[model samples]
Target chain A: MVSIAEHTPAPGRAGGGRLAWAFVERQTNLWKRYWAWELVWLMYGVVNTLAITFIAKQVGNEGAASSINVSKLILFLLIGTLVWAYLSAVLDDISLVVTWERWEGTIEHTLMAPVPRALHLIGMSVFGVLHAVVRTLLIFAIAVPFFSIDFGGANWLTAAVVLAAGSFSIAGLAILAGVLPLLYPERGAQMSFMVQALVLLVSGVYYQVSVLPGWLQVFSYVSPATYILDGIRGGIIDGKSVADTWRTLAALGVFGTVLIPLGIVTFMVAEQWAKKTGKLKRQG
Target chain B: MLDELPLRAAGVAKTFGGGFDYGRLLPWRRDGHAPEPPRRVVDDVSFEIRRREIFGVIGANGSGKSTLIRIISTLLLPDAGEVRIFGLDVVRDTMRVRALINRVSADPSFFRNMNALENLLFFGKVYGLSGRDVREQSPRVLARLGLDWEQALEPMSHLSRGQQQKVAVARALLTSPVLMLLDEPTTGLDPRSKRDVQSFVREVREEHDATILLTTHDMEEAELLCDRIAFLSGGRIVAEGTPVELRRTIAAGRPLDEITMETVFMELTGRSVEEDEEPREVLAHG
Candidate 1:
């Protein structure tokens, strides 16, 4: 017989961290197996980035008399597209947590494992952020050559801070959306996609939030992406320092602090409801 | 001292469905439709398993076999009563209970695109085993269960259902759970694969000193592998005893050898082992 002593897990926090990493490793392996799908997504991301960035070039050419600097406009749209891509990737990965489990018919097995739900979610969030970073970097690298963008005055530190904060806040929102599939399996995944669409519309991924109608602009105040885009644009376009974007940074900080724990709590509550309602069972 | 026991469930019950219908408030003048009433899927069930014993709950489909298993596995909450695993409340000490138990369901649930070794390593790590330990142990477990290492390297979707089931069994055993919940582990296996799993289950109990709670509609399987059997009908245990004792309950002095499990099941539940009950909405809200 294999000795239980030999296989017994390390107790407490250390073990919890390992359990969380297990999800990351599992996701990596799954993605490796689904390389073709990843390739398709990457191709689509590149095409989408190029398509949006080219619009600035078209407007710059068509209206040479206008104040819009062709190179700066292209850079502005590029930043927006790339940031949206990263945010969308993170959101997609995190929000599909339940959907992926259901698709693989492993929802029960994964949930019933010895790991705490919090750690499991944290692991998933970590993977989502990492996966998003890599995919966004690739899209940025491929799309950069197509535009005459300048970065000599770019405030890299401020942009990094904003990106990190925005990722955390978006993770929380994704977790909230993730429970949709757990709560409504038949239409839950589509509901999550719709949540992402709403975020895109309100957050001004492709345009200025100020351009939105006053009623719609109110939502931009609540969206982490609004601050993310504004701060990133300020950093990359005008080279604003961290001190100049303190308000945006503070807002993102508040969002991250509040939404992450809120997401975890909501997920736990939804999990209990799923258990009670038998919604945890695998469904088509 | 209660912690020394392998499993204990007391007056456990679960019901599904029956909530206010918001759809009824829709504006269209329509025939009023009431919400479906709650159905007791597992009604006041209680059972215990001793250390290293193979206890079976045999029932047809929708008899609450899977629900009882889910409750014990800590995947679902009981509406009433308590389940204690090694004296830890399943609800309160869920993490600790989960550590002591692992389950295999009818579906060999997995990331179908990933190879068996990858899946096992992932599950093993979730249960706190290191990758190196899983790598060292999983091959041995798989080989013992009659799965080749080459086969274990193929994507799960590429493997036969029986092979995939073997991988599932290996994943459960990989954790070295003190209590193994096999919820119809052999339901879809081919005959040879079924025998492979059955023998492996017996081997696990004998060698690992693991207490097993298995549910199945396979009468012969229950008779062959279970030290004691409980006949479940409509979310309740209709009868429970050793195979011979269950047979003798309705034998009426007939030679014990002449009584088969099918006959005992027919006598006890008033239905054939092959019969399925009215399908309950297991996934519906309560």
Candidate 2:
């Protein structure tokens, strides 16, 4: 006869922050438990970054570098790789919110909890940003040693500001992608990755957006990644201040303002649809 | 005003996959074919459980027991009718209602790689309890359910099925929900584990003053644990009362003690406890 009242804390006792931190704690614990998977992903990111950066090295060594600054080329490609790594990590973490729950068969339990859905999404987004930041930093640290890169004039504050603004918009897109798995359990996760691939194709992860076809360039206009990359490149390689990249920062701001709310609303609507169609119980 | 009743459902109904096919509007998917009609999973069901009572809804698999539980748990919306927990509408006041209820499904859904204590701590925090509270209270809850603390510290995947089920129960109790929805809680457990869970459920109600709505196919388990029982067949309650009263309905003037739940189930639902209903395909999109 345990006295429940004596043991159970009142609901919403500490406020939404503490409640939201629960997800962060849970995800961290999960990462710890699956350290092997984290190591594998980290290794893959490292190799991918190196392979792309080596193209500049190859071009420089092949006597095609008399006119081009090989160091700047390396830095350009390195920024692209590192930024994409960070952005994609955020995208992957948030988009897999539903996939992870379903895989563990805990979607029902999680949905039935007393917390507001907004808090839940925010919590996951926060974890995504934090997790991506740490991983991206590690990738940067590892890749920098291999290149004789100059960072004497880099405006890191501008890059950081651009990244912060860009992450919100990416989180919004990830939330939208997450709705796919809630609605179509069997193929939704794969569908989410396809969305990421589309973003990659349109956003010029490793090349200039201007180099893409005119019609594809129209998509680049709407992609937050396009602005994010341009802003970061201007800040790091060209050493431009935030004031110099106001237009790019403004574009990301608009995206964040529109997409975050849109994503949350779409996700809520999809959740209702899932409930109506009995999709929540389906694990696949 | 209805807060005194821990649980209540009125004319609750749910149908899956009966609507116009919006997917057909797609250019590549314009095949002219009628959509499948919606199938009623829980039809016009109604019941109530008083505070501190262990109420059971007994039916075979696919008889809508789980669907009903889902509705009450706020995991699903009823197509028609309403459910209230502690005077809160499950639909309109879902978050508030959720604060008062917790559910245990047949599958002990958990993070397999994480240990049980970690999982419990996560769930507890979601319900607004601090991690320190969960850590301090979990050992006692686990011990009360006959689970060793060492076993709970191991990853959930390494634990046996029964042990996993116990962890599920422990997770639910950690929230200290006033209304406990146990959807086939003892399903797939060994007999001894089943008894342990059943006794713990009883102890929960007595000590915690909780109202419990449990769904099960095990008639004997229902008889042993439920204060009152409802016979659910084809998404409706066919008969409901105390065990003796339910048996007496089909007793035909014979001694009530001579009646078995199996006989009552057979007379009322026209099927054995082990029989399963025909499966139906539920469309994910309508």
What TM-score, over all chains together, does every model reach? 0.95, 0.95
Cα lDDT for residue B234, model 1?
85
> lDDT for each of the candidates?
0.89, 0.89
Kindly list the per-residue Cα lDDT of model 1 for residues A7-101, writing each as its tens digit. 35322323678989999999999989999998999999999999998998888778863544777778778998999999999999999999999
Worst 10 residues of 1 chain A by lDDT: A5-14
**lDDT score of residue B59 within candidate 2:** 89
Candidate 2 CAPRI classification by DockQ: medium
Report how far residue A115 has shifted in candidate 2, in Å.
0.8
> Which parts of model 2 are misplaced by more than 4 Å?
A1-9, A282-284, B26-34, B279-286
Model 2, residue A197: what's the lDDT?
93
The local lDDT score (0 to 100) that residue B105 gets in candidate 1 is: 87
Say what the interface RMSD of candidate 2 is.
3.4
Per-residue lDDT of model 2, residues A1-284, tens digit only: 33333433357586998888889989999989998998888898899999999999999899788524888889889999999999889998999999999988899999889888888999999999999999999999888999888899899999999999899999999999999998889999999999999999999889898899999999998889999999999999899999999999888999999999999899999988888788888464
Residue ranges of candidate 1 with Cα displaced over 4 Å: A1-14, A64-68, B28-34, B279-286
Evaluate model 1 with DockQ and give the value: 0.56
Tens digits of lDDT, candidate 2, B186-219: 9899999999999999998888778899999998
